[model samples]
Target chain A: MAVSSQVLSYYSFEQVDITRFRIRPEINRQKVEAEFSRAVYPYITWTDGTELYAGDYAVLIIRSDNPKLCRSGLKVTIGAGLLGAEFEKALSGKKVGDSFSVLWKGETVFVTVESVKNRHKPELSDDMIAALNIPDVKTVAAYQTHLEKKELDEFFFEHSRDAVGYVLKQVQANSSILVTEADWNQTVEWSVNRLAALAAMDGMELRTMTPEDFRGRIPVKSYDELVVLMQREAWESVRMSLLGEYLAKQNGDTINADGYETFLTEAAAPWGRTAEEYRKAYPEAYYLQNEYCDYFRRAVTAYVRKNYFKEEKNEH
Target chain B: MSIKFAEASTFDNLVREDDFVIVDFFSTSCGPCKILSTFLEDLEAELPFLSIVKVNTMEAPELAERFEIHAVPTLFFYQGGELKERHLGVLDEDELRERIERYLY
Candidate 1:
């Protein structure tokens, strides 16, 4: 099931001047400094013979009589509880090549210290940003520009909810794009499934949990009211996404089957699957719906980025 | 107990002493940080056993450096003096509640 909408009459401008909706957000200097500090310590390689400490990235070799525990290259951040509580507590103060057995999940597992990695922070420099190996972001100056662009995009997305609402209202006024009952039902189904998944995470049965019990999340008094509220919210969101899709297409960007297939080929390559394989694995409609929605989002973002600051004047 | 402010000097102590601590690095000028502060206040009132330590990035640059906090509104969840998880943004009430409950029990 795909959400379909058409732009009957285009906006007068080549691109919708997004400047009126844009806000110049303030940047926090300390946050930038901290980010620079993070970039300096992108990763910590194993330092041979170094002792493990709290906050150190530790790699271990498990050598157990049981095949289950014979795993090697188990990485854990000391005091990070990523592996578990006991795994970290046992690794503290341990040096490379040291052998010890720790009780993990009620099983005594033998472990050998493989390597310990500690971040040695460097000064914020082009070399530091380059060390991060982030694509196309090699210099400190480019990173700053990237951060600014990111903030602007964030501001637009966050603040444009109202603007999008206004656009939907205008579309309703000028156009008669039918948001079918099936579309509404699709949204309702999505909400129900999502809420059910969240309930399952808490070990609570969605069918058994009372509305009062779930009121912390959805404030409606009854399940019926909840459905109505969800339907309304979903309708708006679907329209917003479709609108973005419509705008993106009107601006010469391809948000069609061909573009998505090309994107899928690249994405599926990582998983050793071709686009056709992916299509075969899932229902055709499921792929269409997912790809359509993704394209819809990209359309909106592309439209915004291309036109958002197009008319801004130079600052001396 | 409640939301307490921390600097570099007190940051380690707060994380070490408190059984469950959420270190929130924020700035006064940020819009998201402002929104998160209110959520934190409400969260603190609801969950009284945990400590929410607010470290103003402007005041505690050294603390941000030590923790390697990359952004404002960054939350580092610590349990038993060990890092449990770290999140970088304004978490919804339900998500924030879920995280707190996971550690509380």
Candidate 2:
């Protein structure tokens, strides 16, 4: 059965004038120039005595003997400094055309230093711009404008969150859902039990954990207050999840194997898991419901922000 | 639930005349659409007052797009040319009957 049918009524009306949160972002020229430098000739020089060193760019072929290595065989040309502390410790003072072996993160790996060279950051100049081979850009002024415009776009997207946040806050506040008593109890119990589980993880019983034990860490004054906060949190969770679920379905989000796998991969990233592992560990309905919540939030924040939370904008 | 088959050219005309109409947006290749058709037949025999209008979504691409029909076997209920409710998926006989009965004015 659909969530709407179960809820019986989810009267969500009244639209927020998203334009009220209009934002104009200022571009930082220094940052834009740095980004441009990074974008162009990230690693292009080839005159550093062919020695492997920090800040030098090099082509390397990497292979691991460990069968369960994250990436068994990887080869690329990149900045040696970008490789991390483990690599710096092992690869310092090495020479080009040399093959060496090192133990990396518990995995025995082989590295071949194909070529080593120093890459210098180019100055902003018309000559550099001409060398860029960009179709319409052949001057330093044009290049600077291009980088500044790109930076401005990025800044705008970052700052536009206020508009999306306002829309979500307004809709969530205006909407009302019919949560059954059993559902409310289940939500509250589930949230409290998670807290209990956290207490267990820290070798303490939640029932016995005093206010002073929680003080300076959590804002709760007593166990009863904590439970009350948990209930409020649970209600908010349920409300947001239901709204997200309804919005996603109405916006053409469906259950497909490929889409679900993609969702699983992105959703599991913070939890330190692969898509398959997440699928196995997360309960179907729980993750599915959470997916909608995530999707709705993202949809509201995306470039298609004008689509969601529109009360009568669909009028044709 | 008397089945009133509607082509794209006649769909608007069909809905325009009925006081209450259930427009079934379906695809010929859809298995659920086939099953739902049989249930609609039984429903037609049961609820003589119900108006059932079937549109092959495959044959009526424009109509499907206009109604935002994403899935097969979607039903759009109309009362006096205004959309009242939309149900997606194949509903069983009893549930389908119940869904239609409530919309009756």
Candidate 3:
């Protein structure tokens, strides 16, 4: 028996526009694994002492079992300063086999389409059909009617709650999204102004009330009661931070190099500071950077276990 | 058992009567307040010793403000016209009953 050649074509960085390039029809596991094994230069720099060039690169790997309905899926790694907005601009309109480049850092690095691998739509085995409780699992329509209506209803209800819960969770998780001194001062000032307006509505002078005085006059039932409410809100904020960090890590798949950069920018945006600023302000950001990666891994694991892809049935 | 409800204006009269009063401060818009009102109604059905009263904050803002109530629903246990214990937010049905039993009798 002869072994089949499973290796896909590998492209050097000089051949394509890595920023805008895309692979058509998607690639399967064999191609992806091979791509991962291949090494590509990530950074290129000028010999001049004043200039530095950094190329953030990632291997696009589409697992054979990848469930994305799109033509292709990808995994990307990139430098921290690039915003997702840049990649959206670069690759949104481009087709597969197209390539282009833009200035990155101080040097221009060429990017190209290395390979395009076609994939066959996967088939569900008899075991899968039994697991799905369906006689036919070949087409989307086949499985549509067999779904449990009540389960779907419960799912939607749960989904809505989970959506809100996720928001609350994100707020609670990302509590470490540090508010700078200036940002905190700004928020305090805004809150004070709003409070002053409320006081003025009651024919009270804003000048007479300080922040401490304002809190006192708010007529809380008790100190304990106020603390409890504030604590709940704080927890929600922390949850949001954790969720954002989780999202950035789990969905490291991007179509282009710019997309990877954009992800980093968004992941760090909530802190009301740059990723660099966060690292400078708190030594924890350094550890958090890696911790964020771990969070994404956990999120992806949970997401897979939850089987978020299956459409739920409608309930009465 | 008689279930008595006192309007904010009549609260003074009820307190002056030297009756052990359970005053519920509630708002119509609050979900917990609605639940609590039903709970109080059930308590009134079971307990004859204590007078259950409700004050709607929306209708009686002055009374709510007087008590410094920022949130609803709040419960106040009064004995001989003096506040003994106060509960803010939703209270468990059993907890409310226990508090009323300890304070009123």
Candidate 4:
């Protein structure tokens, strides 16, 4: 449910009178140490009297005075702008064992700060470095540098994906895409294979069952209607292919004949086919249409990453 | 509850002997097959006329191949020793009862 702006503006609300608060929030160093010691990845370090600041991961126990809202444990990153403003206000100054009550949707919501995680980079000892065993990363300092590089690579990849997706959406919105007969057949085959795999997992067989056979067995009656649905589903993938070709042409990322042959061989490997057999199975026009589309997307995305993306400082 | 067991050699004989028979093709390591086996055993009591034949695909590789059995727990229905219906996968108790009723009459 969307909370109104008026409710968000008012941080203070009617306080709840609890007959019995099940667990009182209390800051215990021993408990904190134990929790920290158990944590591995994104290692937690215990600190005294640390108020949960913005970007801090805090574990909270939330209970509603109204039985309808119920009680649940919530793991939240404080100041990530995810939690409601009022919820953040109630939690900002609170540390481990502190409790506060907030009004939400005309119901009194009681919140207890279970634990505030104050994280610090673990000591990069030889043991820690050895555990990772990443190539060319021997020292703790080297591992940190390697992580920074990997993070940069990830940032570029994410940005390129978003940019291509945005560009594709706009391009697709403007044009009419025609789903070929071969494309429709491929989609139906994929759908049938997926269904067969799921059935096999349940110790059931779907031996040699085509999409038509599957549709007949299910609630869906009309084969034509199923075809239409499959066509509608295939549009996005078809558009991706079209956009890939368009992007490749626009950016001059063209594949040579030799490169195409090599790609065909690699692509056919999963299907346990030689490139010659694969080419014969799929007509030249059909093969090139899909193959070039994939090649373009990969090429254009790489180009966008290399030329257009910059990494920013990320919150842990 | 009694479930008639079949090997590659006895498979034809088992189906031919019964007026209605269901051959359950399954593997030992298959978890869903185990559940379906228990369900079939319970079902045998409810439908005494329905002769259920259990065939281990591992033991009867030739039978599995002859039937083109790609996945485990495949059920092939036979009436008067002729293949009538084929179903692959775990059926819930209701579905199993309904399928059995469809062939029984």
Candidate 5:
């Protein structure tokens, strides 16, 4: 349902799930171990034909008729969907040394199960933290805190996105807002770069890596499909930004100097820098263009949250 | 109810009195600690047999240091006077419930 381009409804912020706020720390040793194991290079161990369990950790070698699709030493956990369905289907119930060929993108890709390793959940001890090489994470407690903070920040950011979505939906309902070609291009480029960055994090180069090669890694079929999806996402992003700016102007409430100062101080304190030091280092214009605008967008969303939304407090 | 602790000996007594104990290292200034305090209270009501031990790091620096508590809202689960698990940061109600259930069952 498309909203009018000009008029934003008041109930936008109230409709979404604002209660999805709590972020639990990954304290379960089993879960933490599984995640850590997947991130690292899986160990290789030859095994006889045995029924592969759901949680089996293994390294697979994929060979394809398409030169760009051929890949080797790809570490994956069984049944995680990190590898596409074909790879899973090709390997499931088959034991070590199992090989199968599947047609992908008009070419046959041969998959071979090279090695399967019995993964043990490493104890979240000081030694494990040292091996991780994460700064200031010298102990299990520190590591848990680090993970918790990361998850918590992600939760808040997601909540903020929902809040912005609320505003955008109302804005769309009221009037016709136009998407410019420049904005569309910027959004598409941003999506491409973001996807590349994600691929890089997973130890793959996206520019050279073909869609067929990255089948199990990402949820894209062809380059054209990726462009279409990114275009849709970029449009939504641009619309949200436009609505946020419009709502901020409509509210006529300037930034709270004290709140802004506290925000800046808190941000800088983690890096051992004072608010003044941070301000001196980064130009006021730069902060206004990026940080200040983001803060204002949140403020606009929060205004809707406070005035229109009923924060259902969880009694339990 | 969470028993307040100011030193190591008090913590020792608190743990010794209860078979299943959870020590919550919290600070007055920490917002998450305040939220967790209410959750822990709800948990205590749910499992009346469970005992909670509260240690304010600001008031008892030695106890905090002894426990290696670098952050507030850190939870230390104990069974039979031995540390079973340590969880730092905020936990949802379901997560807290699940943790207790695992030990109880």
Candidate 6:
């Protein structure tokens, strides 16, 4: 598929932080919190190795103006990832002033319960629900049961797609320009260090600490073994990047799904495994490869549309 | 009550004393430096065996320049005016503790 012009309009990863500030401060706390909730929260650590916050950098919720919302309890919605689910569970039944720690994005973060606020919980009115569908639901429980099975799934799927779209848009905007080896190295090193910190939080040491001690703390077999696994992961990512660059040069257009299966089959040949076998061994890898291919294709289309197609349009 | 600040002017006097000296060079704006500051403050409270000195880059630009500091935060471990090891950027509290333990003990 050709890259959408909308994808090209996205800002780079470095620009993401700057964009957060562009929102007006006058906006309601709920809206601000909603926006902040979408941000990738970093693991907060004190200088003394104490973790202070486990959830997202920020969180948002809606409730009735009645104080009963505080006493009745709260529900928090997090992303689908492991950390997200964990945060939701941790926040459940938590009252104000309660402090706890949980693994967030692989690192342990400490969280304190902030003040609970009362706000309007937006729901489809009963009349509106009836107007849309003739299903005569009696109680809130029946309506909730109906919504849970289908609507929740649709809502999450839509949000997930939007999040991925945002990242892809960023990648497209950052395309065409070559990243310097220094810049790449810096980013990679920072990622590694962050990973190391996460491992440390899990009580697994990257160096010096014994394997048994590490295993007692983390779910991994050994620190050395984990290091090897991490290295392999990094290598695959780098290899995919090289493949993306190669495809970008050859096609002149982005390599979309039409080229994906062939590319995977050929790429897997060097590893003594068929594409199908590789997919079986690492299903996530296949998904990542497809995504990267799609990104590359979008970048090519974006480059073409911005330069060649625009020029053609101008001529007309 | 004597509130003796860790000033560069007192470096020579501190060298004559019988203690391991740690000079922390840090800027106010650096995240790592800010973290290290709190760490050093905590270390000072807990470890009475050694002297932990802090030098703000804003106030002690001359000392920072003398040390060839190109970064916002740098830690110099010293014993009797001799430099032992230097660390740059953010460090974990455990790591810092171990470093101190190694040097002091």
Candidate 2 segments whose C-alpha is farther than 4 A from its true place: A1-14, A40-119, A122-162, A195-218, A221-223, A255-282, A303-316, B1-105
Docking class of 4: incorrect
User: Candidate 6, residues A133-156: lDDT per residue as tens digits?
Assistant: 437654444555554434433433
Clashing pairs in 4: A25-A97, A26-A97, A204-B89
Candidates 5 and 6 compared: the better one by lDDT is: 5
Q: Is candidate 2 or candidate 3 better by lDDT?
A: 2
Residue A294 error for model 5, in Å?
6.0
lDDT score at residue A114, model 5, on the 0-100 scale: 81
Model 1 chain A lowest lDDT segment of ten? A265-274
Alpha-carbon TM-score of each model against the true structure: 0.45, 0.41, 0.31, 0.29, 0.34, 0.28
Order by TM-score, highest first: 1, 2, 5, 3, 4, 6
Full-model lDDT, candidate 1: 0.63
Q: How many backbone clashes does candidate 1 have?
A: 0
- Candidate 1 lDDT over residue span A1-316, tens digit each: 6754444554422233445654445555655654555465433333444887765666678866677666676555665454567777888889988999987656788989887776343457888777777789999998887666666666667766654544335544554445667766876677666566555545566667787677776777666776788788777655555555565666676544545565545433323334565443333333445554555555545555454443445521
Provide the clash count, candidate 2: 0
Candidate 3 local lDDT, A1-316, one digit each (tens): 6432111222211221222211111124443332222211111111211111122222222222223311122312122222243542443333335555633333333333323222121343434334444455534334333333334444444444443334333433433343334433433444445445445544566666545654657644443444454444433333333444545544573222333333343333322223453333223432343344345435433443244333334311
True contacts kept of each: 0.00, 0.00, 0.00, 0.00, 0.00, 0.00
Docking class of 3: incorrect
Candidate 3 — which residues are off by over 4 angstroms? Answer: A1-159, A164-316, B16-18
Query: Candidate 4 lDDT, tens digit per residue, A1-316?
Result: 7431111111110121211211212234443343233223323343433578754656677787677655444555555334556776678877788888887557778888887765343644656665666788776667656655565565555445556555445445555555556665665655545444444433556664446555645444444554565556555655555555555665687643445566555444333334675454444544555665677556545545444532233411
Candidate 6 Cα lDDT to native: 0.47
The B-chain TM-score of model 4 reads 0.92
Error of 2 at A247 (Å): 2.3
Q: What's the distance in Å from true for residue A185, model 6?
A: 25
The iRMS of the candidates, in order, is: 18.3, 30.0, 28.7, 21.0, 16.2, 20.8
Evaluate all candidate structures by whole-model CA lDDT and list the values in order. 0.63, 0.63, 0.44, 0.59, 0.60, 0.47
Instruction: Report the C-alpha displacement of residue A38, candidate 6, in angstroms.
Output: 30
lDDT of 2 by residue, B10-50 (tens): 88888867567888887665677888887776554334345
